[model samples]
Target chain A: SQQGEEDPQALSIQEGENATMNCSYKTSINNLQWYRQNSGRGLVHLILIRSNEREKHSGRLRVTLDTSKKSSSLLITASRAADTASYFCATDETYFQGAQKLVFGQGTRLTINP
Target chain B: EAGVTQFPSHSVIEKGQTVTLRCDPISGHDNLYWYRRVMGKEIKFLLHFVKESKQDESGMPNNRFLAERTGGTYSTLKVQPAELEDSGVYFCASSPPGVTDTQYFGPGTRLTVL
Candidate 1:
């Protein structure tokens, strides 16, 4: 079973619109990180919010983590065509010997129209 | 600084054949991880190596898959007698010591089995 699941399997919006994607996890985590994967490319680290942090902002991206709800949301302001990609949320949990592994979600595929 | 790099961006092989994928992490990074994403499925963790030691491999699917990191540097994943279900994108990531939040990913190897 997957530990994290993202909402809205696909999304399409205009260039200037804001895009929001949500992720829900089943267990406690040390931190939740978001990544983007362009077509045929590697995953790019987006933003990470620790379990203790409620919200974080980087450039035009906003990420909020609600541990009580075990959910997180990523908001991309002023979307661009280049932002078209699959966004995934990964949960990092402490394993044996303090080593960690990330459990990823199915991801939300977003397309920004010009 | 160079980012993580993977060789053979794409590979096509028939079932019962062998395929090897390589990943070279950034300089001085000690933590390396492997992940896979099958068609229409979420990316899943395969294994993790900390300086040439198998820190965790709970997500590895089966015994046919072998991974090695010699001298705590570049790593290789070999699949012998590959099955049809083993076809997917193989991603390798690395994080620097003491930093678990961010991981640099390499452009994955897309494996296709006929």
Candidate 2:
């Protein structure tokens, strides 16, 4: 069973607008990280927020985590056409042999139209 | 520094054939991981390795899938008698020791089982 599920599986906006994606998970997590994938290749790490933290910012990316709600959101301000890609939320949970491993959500596909 | 790398960017094989996918993590990264995204599904963790030792493999689907990391530097995932449901992107990632949450991903191998 997938641990996380992303909402608004697809989103489209103008280049200057902001894009927000939401993710909800089922289990307690050590941290939640967002990633972007372009052309279905490697996934680029965007940002990470620890369970103890509420919000974080890096450049134009903002991430918010709510452990109480078991949810997270990622906001990309001042979106650009180049920002078009698939975004995924990964949650780190306890796995076999006591290793904390990440489980990802179904990605939200965001398209920034120029 | 060079990021993680995966071999045979794409592989097409028959149902009973064998396919081997390789991943080389960044230098000095001893923690390796394997994941995959099936058709229209979320990414799922396959396993984790810590310095040539199998740390976690709870997500591995079955015995037909074998993952090995030699010398804690590079890893390989072999699928014997690949099934149609196995066609998807196989991704490998590595994180430096003690940084288990932030992972660097490799360009995934697109496995197409015909």
Candidate 3:
């Protein structure tokens, strides 16, 4: 069974607008990370938030994690056409001995229209 | 500073045939992982290796799928007697030791079992 599930499987917005995607997980996690995949490309690391951290920001990306709700969100500000891609949220569950493997969620497809 | 790399970006084979996918993680990265995404489904973890030792393989679907990392450098995933349900994108990821939160991914191998 998949540990995380992303909400709003698809989202489309103007290039200058902001895009937000949400994810919910079933288990306790050591950390949560967001990744992006361009068409025909590999997944790219975006942002990571530890279970003890509430929010983090990197360039135009902001990520928030709520352990109480077992949910997370990724917000991309001032989206660009190049931001069009699939975003996935992955969880490193604490149950694993070393927490090496990551369980991923069905990605949210975001389209930034120019 | 070469990133993770996977060989044979795309593969097409008939059912019951064997296919081998290779992944070379970033140098010095001991944590190697394998994941796959069936069409329209979430990407699922297949296994993990730390320095040539299998750390966690709880997500492996079955015995037909074999993953190995020789010398703790590069890894390979072999699927024997591939089935139609096995067609999907196979991804390889690696994280630096002690850094389980972020993983670097390689261009995935798209396996199409006909």
Candidate 4:
């Protein structure tokens, strides 16, 4: 089973507008990370928020995590045409007795209209 | 430094044939991971390798899929007698072991099993 599910599977917005994507996971997670993928390319790490932390920011990207609700949201401000890509939320949970591993969501396809 | 690299970028093979996908993580990265995503499905972890040792392989579907990292640098995933279900983009990620939740990815190898 997939660990995380992202809502609003597709989103379209103006280049300078803000975009928000939500993700809900099933189990308790050690941490959650967001990544961006351009067409036919691999994902690039954006930001990571641990369960002990509530929010994190990196440049134009902001990530919020609510461990109690097993949910997280990623906000990309000042979006650009280069930001048009698939965003994915991946979860790290305990497994193999104690080791932690990451499982990914289906991804949210965001289109920044230029 | 360089990022993760994978080749050949795309491969098409008949069912029952064998295919090998290779990944070279960034220099000095010891942790390597393999993931796959079928059409309309979320990306799933296939395995993880830490410096030539198999750290976790719980996500591998079956014996037909085998992953190996030699000299703790480049990794290879071989699918023997490939099935139609094997068609998808295969992604390879690498992290410098102690970095909390940071994984860099390769461009990915698109495998087409016909």
Candidate 5:
């Protein structure tokens, strides 16, 4: 079952603009991670924000977590044409006994028009 | 360092045919995972392997799907008598044992069932 659900099923923006995606999950999690996938390629690990952490940043990417609301958001600043892809948020719903199955959300397809 | 690798970048088969997909994780990575994205839905977890053992397979769809990780170096997922609903992108990922929840993914295998 998919525990996380991403908003803005699709988004289109011009290059140099910022793209923000949001995800909402059902249960408590140890951490939240975001990923990106180019067309016909696998997902690439982005940044992770633990439940205890409210926000984190890597390069031009920023992630904010709100455990009280069971939601997380990813913001990509100064998006490039190459940044056109799908973004997914995964939550660690179960991390017991080494079974860390990441429950993913319905991704957001972001298109950066050049 | 080489990341996770999967064989047969794409496979097309008729319904009811059997297909076996392979995944070779990063060297010395004790954790291996299998996930699939079907149609336009979310990418979902299939199973998790710790070394050579099946640590978790709670998300496997049905008996037609079987996964094995012999020798703990590489893993294989087999679908017996595949159905049209089984068509999707199968991904393989690996992560080292640590506090990090980062998972490196492989170029997924695109499975088409007609």
Candidate 6:
């Protein structure tokens, strides 16, 4: 079973537009990270926001986490054609052995048009 | 400076056959993980290896699947008598096992069982 679920299974937008994807989790998380997968090959780490933090930013990517609601959102501003890919949100939990384990969401497929 | 590497980008085999996939993690990374995503499903964790020991393998499905890391540098996952349900993309990831570090991923190996 997966802990996180991302909304908007598919999205299409023009270049320079903004794309937003939302993720909701079931349990408490130590940290939530976002990744980008191009053509289902490899995944690239995008950004990670700890539970204590509310928001984080890197380049054109902005992530917001609301522990109260157990949900997070990724906002990509000024999107480009290169940004077209599948976006996934992963949540990390601490096991009894004190190791961090990651659980991923279903992912959102975004298409950027030029 | 190199990313994680995986061999046999894609494979297609008939049911009841065996398949082996290899992953070479980045040097000096102590934490290694294996995950897979079936068609129309989320990525699920298969196991975790810290150094040469198997720290967690709760996600392994059955006895037909086996994973090993000899010297903690590289790992191999072998499936004997593969089934149709085992067709999916297998991903390998590694991290430094510390605070505020990200997990690096490899370009997964896609396996298709006919």
Q: Can you list each candidate's DockQ?
A: 0.78, 0.79, 0.77, 0.66, 0.67, 0.64
Best by DockQ: 2
User: Model 2 off-target regions past 4 Å?
Assistant: A96-98
lDDT of 3 at B95: 89
Q: Model 2: per-residue lDDT, tens digit, B16-74?
A: 89999999999999899999999968999999999899988888999999999887789
Better of 2 and 5 by DockQ: 2
Q: What lDDT tens digits, residue by residue, belong to model 1 across residues A1-114?
A: 437899988999999999999999998888999999999999999988999999999999999999999999999999999999999999986776777888899999999999
- Cα lDDT tens digits, model 4, B9-52, are 99999999999999999888878889999985888998888889
Worst 10 residues of 4 chain B by lDDT: B94-103
Which digits, one per residue and each the tens of the lDDT, describe model 2 over residues A1-114?
438788889999999999999999988888999999987668999999999999999999999999999999999999999899999999988755556788899899999999
The DockQ score of candidate 4 comes to 0.66
lDDT of 2 at A26: 89
Write the number of the candidate with greater DockQ, choosing between 4 and 6. Answer: 4
DockQ of 3: 0.77
Give the whole-model CA lDDT for all candidates, comma-separated: 0.93, 0.91, 0.91, 0.89, 0.91, 0.90
Q: Which stretches of candidate 5 lie over 4 Å from their true place?
A: B98-100
Q: In candidate 1, which residue ranges exceed 4 Å CA deviation?
A: none
True contacts kept of each: 0.73, 0.93, 0.83, 0.68, 0.66, 0.63
Error of 4 at A81 (Å): 1.3
Candidate 3: which stretches are off by over 4 Å?
Answer: none
TM-score of each: 0.97, 0.95, 0.95, 0.94, 0.96, 0.96
Winner by lDDT:
1
